[model samples]
Target: MKLQKVLSALVTVLMVALLVVATSASTSAQEPKQNDGEDQTNLDTQLYLIVATNQSVADEKLPAALDSVVKQLRATLPFKNYRLAATLLNRVKNEGRLDLSWIGAPIISAQSEVSPLTPSFSSFKIRVVKLAKNTAGETVVQMAGFNFGARFPIQTMSVASANAVPVINYENTGLQTDISIREGEPVIVGTLNVGPSGDAIILVVSAKRTSR
Candidate 1:
């Protein structure tokens, strides 16, 4: 009976020691799970995005555009809030722009000048199309002649796929267009006809410039 009692005491002590050790380990892990210093370091490392919008686009549109720009930023990077600005086209040309600029001291200067919707943005333009009309109210197009006449540029431009007609028309057309491809290559645009309404598409085509 004495031997059995001693053995029972040893077993109880071993179980108590094991519980204490496990509790200590768990407390240690929980204590360091959220360190203020480490959290501050993470915040310091977060990135930023700068958005630029045209003066013509309404202020209400800014919110929707901002949401889209934010979604794009999230898809490309890991961040939340982004900077917003309303800038002119001329200013964008002179200044650089971006929707998401990594926060770092080295690229700060260049990031300040970048406009998110400038010619330098990737996926800007691979194809170009425009439509116009004369005084007679005849439908004008850059490439086509009829229902299919309005879809010529997409059919011919190298940027467009073989069967990708009209898909790249961009619907609207104007008088003169200056489309800038990658490497600052300017593709001059001209319109051949307008629609039957005779309302000539009088517009100055320029490289699309927006901060978003």
Candidate 2:
């Protein structure tokens, strides 16, 4: 009888061990994946902020990178000249968020300007950035809540006296929208009017997939 009882206990222990192993295996299978391609694709995006104006400056020459765009702008825009004001670059992973702010944009200074110009404050953001293949099997970047904003300084009044400080004011320009563009292609997100002069600011965005 003792032997029979011992055999039954052994069988129960074996069943318990099997149940534990099965539970562990099921849990492991249900866990989330790591470093999956769906979430690992990454890219670097370049942002160019160009100022278009009718005012002629000493340096009318723009960046060589924007040669094609300059021609297009000259054809479409009423402004006779264009100059690069700022360029921002950032890298983000698929399904990621990018947010940045700075006080680094060049102040609006035309030719023969004597007073100092205030530094421009700017911000850029993308709430959700993703990399995906399109219908043509080409990779594109999709962005939600893409936004750009800036506060540009303008000289309200020149100093009347040596003891008097220059009166200044600020003008705002920017846009916000969702966008999707193919990799390595530069896109103009939006155009905005800035400062007292009839100058316009054009935003260009270029993206390249750097990793998968």
Error of 1 at 209 (Å): 30
Could you give candidate 1's per-residue lDDT for residues 1-100 as a string of tens digits?
Answer: 9999999999999999999999999989888576565311100010112422222222233334235444554465433323332221221221222122
Sequence-dependent TM-score of model 2: 0.75
Best by lDDT: 2
Please report, in order, the local distance difference test score of every candidate based on alpha carbons.
0.30, 0.81
The true-versus-predicted C-alpha distance at residue 173 of model 1, in Å, is 25
lDDT of 2 by residue, 121-209 (tens): 88999998887788999888888899998887777886878687778787787799999988888877888887778888899888887
Off by over 4 Å in 1: 27-32, 39-212
C-alpha RMSD (angstroms) for model 1: 22.8
